[model samples]
Target: MPAQEDSSTRVLEDLDAAAVDYATRIAGASGPARAALRDELTRICLPFAGRMARRYRGRGENLEDLEQVARLGLVKAIDRYDPERGSFTAYAVITISGEIKRHFRDRTWGVHVPRRVQDLSLEVGHASMVLTTELSRTPTPAEIAARLNVSLPAVLEALESAAGYSPSSLNAPAGGDGAAEFGDLLGGTDSDLEMVDDKLTVAGLLLRLPARERRMLAMRFYGNRTQAEIATELGISQMHVSRLLSRSLAWLREAMLNDTLPRWEGANGPTDPHGMQIAVQSGGGVVTVQVRGEVDRDTAERLRTVVRHAVSSLAGRGLVIDLAAVPLVDAAGVAVLLDAASAAAVAEAELTLTGAQPYVARILGVSGLQSLMR
Candidate 1:
């Protein structure tokens, strides 16, 4: 593909001269004229996402998949864009970034990112969101640890995964009475009728989730048990259950964001994205959880499912994340903490981690997540 150097360097106004030609081609949308213009437009927007893509290149398991994500953003910008909305380059850049973020979020739920990893990442995001929502500002890493009852380092580690990421809120509308908002945290999952059928509904999306995530969702959402109760039922510690639930909610969130699932002829299945992760959770009323042992990638998925479930089910008003036996956590382990943090935010629970190691604190400080706690 030929590069549009002007779109890469020159201003949008200057690019307008070229835009006019493409506009005609897009408007034409019929023949060779349209083909040439579409190709040209793609050429122009592709490079805008290069810088952001660089950050996740080797970091992301699939580089080709990442570029496709970037391409998806570029196309969306060209399609919905107006030449008048400032520089086309700037517009493309924003669209590209949005696309990349969306990919990360989706990947966090659906694929290249394991369901467990995404769940943990979601927790960190949720914690940050909770701080911002409750205090109307960014809370420091210390506050998060204080809230979860964990040590300063654990909180920092959780925050680290969310360094360049921001948390997203469910657009659940305000009720008519506008009653106590936090009190409403005691409600059930707000699944729509769309999830009832065998296609785009919650059940269908559940198929995409990993087996552990699927089972937890069932016991929690369909069983109607508290987090602690579920923990007893599953024979896992209450904290383990809590962490799993929290991760589950994050996956459900990602799945919910995927409103459309393609259905094949005679096959009611959605084609999984090239790279993805889908967060989903909701069930029960209140929960208390307990966790032990050092967390790593191998065990991270279990942790994520637990945390997400805890949050989505509104298991309790507060969460106590006990890290007493956890001696060391790698980068992947930190990701799991983030997962629980994100869920706790939505469930309106105070998440605290207890007995963090000095080594953990050093990791958190190096990651620059200390600022998220108050």
Candidate 2:
């Protein structure tokens, strides 16, 4: 066994030596010689695929998707690498992270969890953030447990879950306000600016959510599913889905809505306003308002304003309020929505709700809108 193992190691060493030689030659040459580097890059990046994939084990994202994203990042790093500046590890780290961030910004999750659990996830994240900042470094689970007053196992669990979580995406363009955008988080590189917009960071928000709620949010948003469909798929009552949605939306609003500029926002400005999308202006019937946090009565009031603004121009078009993407909302949302629909009707427009969710649907049904919807 020892002889065989040594021989296998020597064979690997010989292959590595030949690969490096080929890569170094390709790096110095132009044109077709660059082709030689491709195989070497594929070989070098094979190991990184697992490491990055491991980082994403707990989040509800698909392993295949994670591996694909990581692989693309690795390839990109190899292609764009410049030996003039730094080590391969540093470059690869940035590359893999950048790719992951893009996925976080653009992709939705594959599973759902509960609202209380979602909020707990957020609290755990906050605790980690506070502990990291206060300690000026990453803290052990025991240390985190001490600070959070939770069990060490809980702290470990949070860390493990968060390991798969992508940091908030910074996809806004440079300088709507010139510095309040999330693109600033990656140090305002023109290259990074082209990635997904920070405003689209629904993925990171989902990770902060409780596991079950996160799963539900994934199915609803990414799946573009109707409440009834979601209910049937999850084997739960539509009313239950609606309720879970309401709670989760409130949590999402809390995670996504911001008053002060986030650290990343200092360099990248806000995205093109909601009205800039051709979909919004061409009467496509979509409205995106930046509701600050916690979709309770107050946020619901704000949402009413958004709904009014969205429908003000369409005037009798099918009114589809998109709540499929939010992380939280509450019981008050039903009243606000019903009121908005009434207000829209008063303006002589019909409101055809598309994403009423199970809980929200039940609330409306129980509140006497079932016959109206039918």
Candidate 3:
């Protein structure tokens, strides 16, 4: 035993010397030099880490994971340690133990408990074990609380929280017969089945729209193509695309809410030199209007007109204005959205603004029209 003690003391002294040297070299070193020194220090400290990790071996975590945690803690301690503070061994032990405790606190909790309660539980557990050994009897909560200089209620709460340390698996056996699993006894209902009729109705409605409108909807939503890309493909101005899109969406909104087919007015309409393009699609009792280009003083009235048309035509279905492609929106554009929202409210229909670009969203946010967005 004396020989073993002598060997242990020598090993500790050597490790401490090595730690101080690494700290001094790492302080002056940079780039590859610092990295190599850190690697060497880590190797020297690994055995200390393993020793610390062994303290937590019987816990739920794998021994290897705990060792890795301890090593990480050692690396951090090495980086942060000042040789002036004291011996490396003491600092390493504290840092390594803290890292292991943190791992257990963060990862092992089956249910979330307050950090204070978790810490108290650990203290209470350790104290109870010590008291039980000393007294040769189980320690009461009051005794543990007095020993720890805490309230009895706090001790009781900590003791109660011990059960949450390890949660039962969902796959565990449900009963003593072992015929059923816990998961088998649980019940759930599929909510998606409720929307089948609505989906079918929307699919039929989509089929009735003009071929051009259908293609535009497919490209915008399915292909995820920008309005500019769609405009380039169709050889039309982005503004023209916006208007066509809006008018198309408004018509579909009217049809779905009224449960009637829309009369096809040919796609050709009066061109605006400074107006946004609008595309509309309807499904599942909601009509989505895709607006592109700028919405400022010049084009705000056009937006109001198109949205008002949609609101007027719909009986009860909701309308969503999508502004994902609109690069800019000003005060006038915000007014148009507010007006549309108010009109929808009066009509007893919900209006939602969807996919506004950042600049456009910021404008709406400043104007307090953000509440209308979904």
My TM-score estimates for the predictions, one after another, are 0.29, 0.28, 0.45
Best by TM-score: 3
TM-score of 3: 0.45
Q: Which stretches of candidate 1 lie over 4 Å from their true place?
A: 1-17, 109-374
For candidate 3, the per-residue lDDT at 5 reads 100
Per-candidate Cα lDDT values, in order, are 0.59, 0.59, 0.81
Count of clashing residue pairs in every prediction? 76, 41, 10
lDDT of 2: 0.59
Across residues 164-258, which tens digit of lDDT does each residue of candidate 3 receive? 99977879999999899999888888788888977787777777665566788889988999899988786555765676578678877777678
Give candidate 3 regions above 4 Å deviation.
1-9, 132-137, 182-374
Off by over 4 Å in 2: 1-23, 28-30, 109-374
Worst-scoring 10-residue span by lDDT in model 2: 264-273
Cα lDDT of model 2 by residue, 321-364, tens digit: 54433333456666776787787677776665544456456656
Which consecutive 10 residues in model 3 have the weakest lDDT in total? 264-273
